[model samples]
Target: MTADARDLARWSETLAGIARTGMAFTESLYERERYEEVLHVAGDIKAAARAAADEVEVEREVDHFVQEWMESIGEGVPGYVTPKVAIGAIVGNENSEILLVQRKDSGIWLYPTGWADIGYSPSEVAVKEVSEETGIECDVSRLLGVVDGQRMGFSRFGMYMLLFHCTATGGELNPHPLETGDVGWFSRDELPEATAGAAWWGSMAFAAIDGEQAPATFDPVRDAIWRTDDT
Candidate 1:
């Protein structure tokens, strides 16, 4: 199906409205086969706007389009639609041993992390997750990186993850009931069989260890596999 320039302009304008309100666009609005159509329209609008030579107006429109596109179909809820936030922590001890948790539901060993709740910032979400999962009090230090866990299938609810470097402030390591079965500190060399998905372990660890500020979004399906310096 061919998308006309007018259609593109209209979609672009609609997207701008969506961005302004932070509204989620329902996937049900368009069938799966129509995704390509939408994408084509978006591209045409972008190209025409760019070719117009009105740089400022074009940029504004492009920014609006990008923001709206992200707000609508960026991440969370593959088929339906919703906003999701996730948090990950680089929790370590005085011995520099990083803490890991074995989740009860998935039986995956991952860093203490979970979805961001309604009333918390991303950092607060990380701290809350750490405390809830490991019974540890931690102070969020710095943002290690943000990763798109959606493509990697690490996110259960199609959420994006914000990873943080954290310091254990107090409290002992006590696994949360049912949510986590085990909690342990592992040295860099003595990592456990991670119950968390491979992508989470790989990306979170690399960002924390190397102190890299990765892109805010990474689609594992489109991006290359996570690789360490040696790899």
Candidate 2:
């Protein structure tokens, strides 16, 4: 998708999040009305973005976005809007091959990843996700990268992907019966054509796998925080 469409969607989501957070805390009727207005405007922007991206009139109404955001509102800290967290593992075997899985829903190949569970530490989530998705018993070596899922086009909603490098201690290539369609160990040069986001993450993953002593990577602050292509 073009940067404009993505930027519009991002902006709309940001506005909706802010408004929802405000609504969660404010007690004044006037303030709630103001927040609702903001939500309405945000819905319009998101709908326009969808239409622009698809190059067709969207049947979904702007109220769809508003209603979804409204349903997510809570009364206290739970209502504080923030990006959702997901954990990803780049597990490498003794052969220096990377472990990847084909997502059942999208058929796109990526490292084993899942939503961060509430009770587990981030690294624990990484280990658990790998085992659950690919039947790989892995130990986290280090943090590999922290990436924005929306900015990377991996998701439409706000999310932070915590990527970890891991060593595949044991397990066969047993794909999860539900989550993954296939699983395999692939050399860096032979990554499947359908592998997702390899351009940005592939080199960093391989570097960590190769025993590089480097700091964990993250998205740098943009000069214009709201701009689409600032990098």
Candidate 3:
């Protein structure tokens, strides 16, 4: 089918999902072969739509991604593939400062966040991520928001970010040596540099921190959410 950018992205993501599930669940060699072929076609879809300047390079990159994804495949019961859940904390201190961490790899400042462990509840995960990333003990108050990571362009795969509002209980400023570069509490007026989505999140975050009585924030419905050009 002829495709636009949104169509390409949708096709790529859908086929990738099928390919990954096939890798994890299918024991049949023929099925695996078919899925791998789908992976190649899905990868090339993006290049075909836009990155077509050098098709060969795009193919190489897509192959690399498929290989990496294959390497990271976690074994599961044959056919239960689904989106993963991540947890984040928007911790606020008594002073009304929000807890922030600079990621070691990206150098971007954001609320403390991590993948949710199997045994932990969402609130528990929130508190744990805050403590582990920023050395800040916290108590989760309530769910702040939930975002579709892929839809938000924060992830290539299907995932959800469960963000919780929290109150800092204790602990000193100490960043995780491996996962975090720096960590601290910052008031809205004194936020650090390179904070991801600060323009979209700044006011809402601060409002939550400042004890505002409002509904939890969520991504608004769009006529075409996958399309970048919204008018």
Candidate 4:
């Protein structure tokens, strides 16, 4: 997709997220009705953004997503909407192998990751995720990177991922019972099939794993943070 189209889609998703979050937290019927209208507008924007590529099924998919989003609303506390935070770990062993797991739901390979919990710090969550998902004990060494998950097409709602570099401390290899289908360690050149966004972070992750002075990565400042146009 063109950059402009991608920008439009992201905005649509952001607007939809705001509307849903509002619907969840607000008890006022009038406010909810307004939020519902925002949802409808978001759905239209999403469908139009997708339909730009001449896809016929775009409308159905967009409508279905909106309907599901509306149905999923529950009583939520009132606050400004924000992205959900997730933690991920890049665990590298002495053998220069990085740990990975295949998600049961998506069947795609990614580093150990999980939603942030209330009591855990970001690095604590990262360590916990690695152990829980891959049966690999790791010590959180340093933060590797932070990423906007929605912009990466990895989430339906807004999310930000905090990735950490970790050292394999101890543990036998075993996949999580319900979350993973398989888990393994791989070298830099031997990443598994169906890996998500490996091209972007693979080198940095490997560098950090290798004890190199790897700088953390984040999205660069865009000319118009919200717009895709060059000028």
Candidate number with greatest lDDT = 2
Error of 2 at 65 (Å): 0.6
Checking candidate 1 for backbone clashes, the offending pairs are: 108-195, 108-196, 109-195, 109-196
**Candidate 1, residues 1-231: lDDT per residue as tens digits?**
122333334344343333323323344544433553554455446556444533435534555545445455543334234336778888877777788998787777778888788888888888888988898898877876666543443332235678788878899889999798899887776777654554446555645555455544444342323322233
lDDT value for model 4: 0.84
lDDT for each residue of candidate 2 in 8-75, tens digit (9 for 90 to 100): 88898999999999999999999999999999999998888889888546556687889999999998
Alpha-carbon error at 157 in model 3, in Å? Answer: 2.4
lDDT assessment of candidate 3: 0.78
TM-score, model 3 to reference: 0.81
For model 3, what is the error of residue 133's alpha carbon versus the real structure, in angstroms, after optimal superposition?
Answer: 1.4
Which candidate leads in TM-score?
2
lDDT of each residue in 1-231, candidate 3, tens digit only:
222444566557677777877778878999888988887787777556445433345655777766765665555654455778999888998899999999999999999889989888889988888888888888888887888776666665678888888998889988999999999889898998788878866887788889986777677786865564534
How do all the candidates rank in terms of TM-score, highest first?
A: 2, 4, 3, 1
Q: lDDT, candidate 2, residue 69?
A: 94
In angstroms, the error of model 3 at 225 is: 6.6
Model 4 C-alpha lDDT per residue in residues 74-184, reported as the tens digit of each score: 667644557889998989999999999999998999999899999999999998888889888989888888998767766645789999999999999999999999999
Off by over 4 Å in 3: 1-10, 22-33, 46-56, 69-79, 220-231
TM-score of candidate 2 on Cα atoms, chains taken together: 0.96
lDDT of 1: 0.62
